[model samples]
Target: MNFLTDELDYEECDKEINKNDINYFRNIWLAYDDFWHKNKYDKSKYKYVKTAPRSPNTKYGKINDFYRRCYLILETNEYYYPLDNYIKIKKRKRTLTNLEHIIIKNSGNGKRQSDVQDIVKNAKFSKTYMTNVMKNAVIGVEKIKEKKILLPNEKLFVNMDDCFISSLFNNKKQKNRIRTISANKGTDLEKSTKSRNVLKDKKITYMKTKNGERIKRQELIDKIYDFLDLQFIYNKSSLVFIGDGAPWIKTSAKKENIPYVIDRHHAFKALKKGFIFNRKVDNKKLTNAYNLFINGKYYLLLDFLKVNNIDEKIYKYFKNNKEGIINQKENWNQGVCAESDVSHLVKSLKGYGAKIYNDKVLNNLLLINSARINKLNLLL
Candidate 1:
């Protein structure tokens, strides 16, 4: 309490100290002291007072003596009659692996199954765990039908994506969060959170590694379309989704029947590229950037600038290309939430590089955005 209100609380305490008419300080001081030191204690802190640990026993006690006697008998190769009659524990107890962890995590199954292993592995666990993990990831599709996470009428305007993590086994394998592989990482979801939105409680829909490049664009669109049907919303004094102008993003809006705006990243890139091209540069690259933007080859926009050269200030580069920026105004406005959404995705799954054995696990990781949204919105 002193730390929070500083010494001021102490002064307040002293003001009421001594006389019973004035009020005793013990209750006031103890409560305040406890409040400030809540975290310094454990449990929920400040709400419930944790009992101080019970004093250790000075006597050996009955249970302790019983255990010692049993140990002595076992050491002497003498099995007690009652001890022998105690049922033995089973052999080969199944421990869940990383893949199993994901399957269970993703297993809501519209409440048909509470057992994770049931829907995930059909109740079998083995090396085939990796293969079935893929089957479970596909269960994410079923998950969308009745989102256990997203509240009714909640909209997911974001896209989820991840690169097929490249493998270390001669760089042949690709890892997803639920599916681990060879890639190290740049995947921390919060690391992906830019400094600007730091204080905001913004975990709207976004993709983590789902944007990476491993999952196909068509697959994303199909999932969105199918999920949107499950989420069929009739009105919007209640919900809205935001995302950038990725092609798949626009297509998802059409499929979901939910209103959305394409986020500004694509347009922003075009603006940056335009300035780079206008400024003096080698001829071949200049033509390529212009052609790429004009052709809606948006992904190429950033790479084009990088591969050619970018000596100008990023702001100036955008300013010089202001005309290019204007061209994307509608898209920029529509996709404004792209920054918030996708960046969050990157933050949550950033450090995890575990191999995903299947689609079920992959989709489980992708659902974090929805899970977070539901968690926050629980207040409403």
Candidate 2:
């Protein structure tokens, strides 16, 4: 009974002559006005449109398009690695990537194809194509495979760390993906006390897999190199790399032939472990000895009498032995550059109490650093 299979030869949907039909339409609309207002909104859709029995064709279309969109996300994101071309979608040149769009639309309120057809009764494209676009407009992993991952220049003062995440971990509340994090360090005394999600648009040098279980170490390096190649296409001196003196970073330094700075924070970490952590040294002696060495007054350290000085006195240390002077002079000034670096950068950031990298943590770092570097001209 609901079937209007044949094309309409009737007059237009006008109110003047077909007053009865118009009244009937009004009654139907009034019955469900609030329903459409609450759901995925389409202001133009009239309530006169009744929910008819589901059609096999409509169901088939929904199922097919859903699968197609899923395919688009899978195929496009993967296949379209290093996307060198601009995307024109629905008359807009957009950065809304294929996968991003798919994820965005499906995640929000939108019209279903079946209900839409009842209101419009006509369409710009075939029902199939429209359904396909709406259902699976998201780009796929395949497209991503074809896309070239972009790499921005090695911006200076860029914070760097690596992380692992997976849902398989036992932390039910946390393991939306289980993850571990580490900074670039020569001797990684401890993993980073930071979050995995904190670097999304920050650092401008890396990305995480949506799967959350995957990691990116060397991949970040490769992507950065590729990005550098592109920048070299424009200007040769756009960026620089900054991280602690880890072996991997040092290797990347050689490979990319980029300048490297041992992050001042990590430099202080070495001092904390070596000089600061030593139990044999007392604070007074250590401080005075260091000051003496800094002033190039290694011998005056005994006048400041301390544990090492006491040890020297027990052996008639001042009279019989004097290797301490030579030892302090050789090392104290030699590594001052590294220690001075720590005093500057580490103290500047107050690089302590690092936290786990969650969305909030990552966003803060990314946003703050971005504003500082690109706008304030604060961080290079």
Collision count for each candidate, in order: 47, 56
- Compared with the true structure, model 2 gives a TM-score of 0.30
TM-score of each: 0.33, 0.30
RMSD of 1: 18.1
The lDDT of each candidate is 0.36, 0.31
**Which TM-score value belongs to model 1?**
0.33
Give lDDT tens digits, candidate 1, residues 1-380: 34453333334433544234222432343454444444343323223223221111111111112110111233344322211122111122122233344444543323212343444343344445433443444223223333323335333233333233222233334443321111011123464466532312233243334324454556665554454444433233223334333344445545555454332465445444545444544457556655555444544555666655554454244333332333343332223324333344433443333332234433554563355443421110
Model 2: lDDT equals 0.31
Q: Which candidate is the best by lDDT?
A: 1
Residue 74 Cα positional deviation in candidate 2, in Å, after optimal superposition:
33
- What ranges in model 1 sit over 4 Å off? 1-172, 175-222, 235-262, 273-335, 353-370, 373-380
Instruction: Evaluate residue 197 in candidate 1 and report its C-alpha lDDT on the 0 to 100 scale.
Output: 28
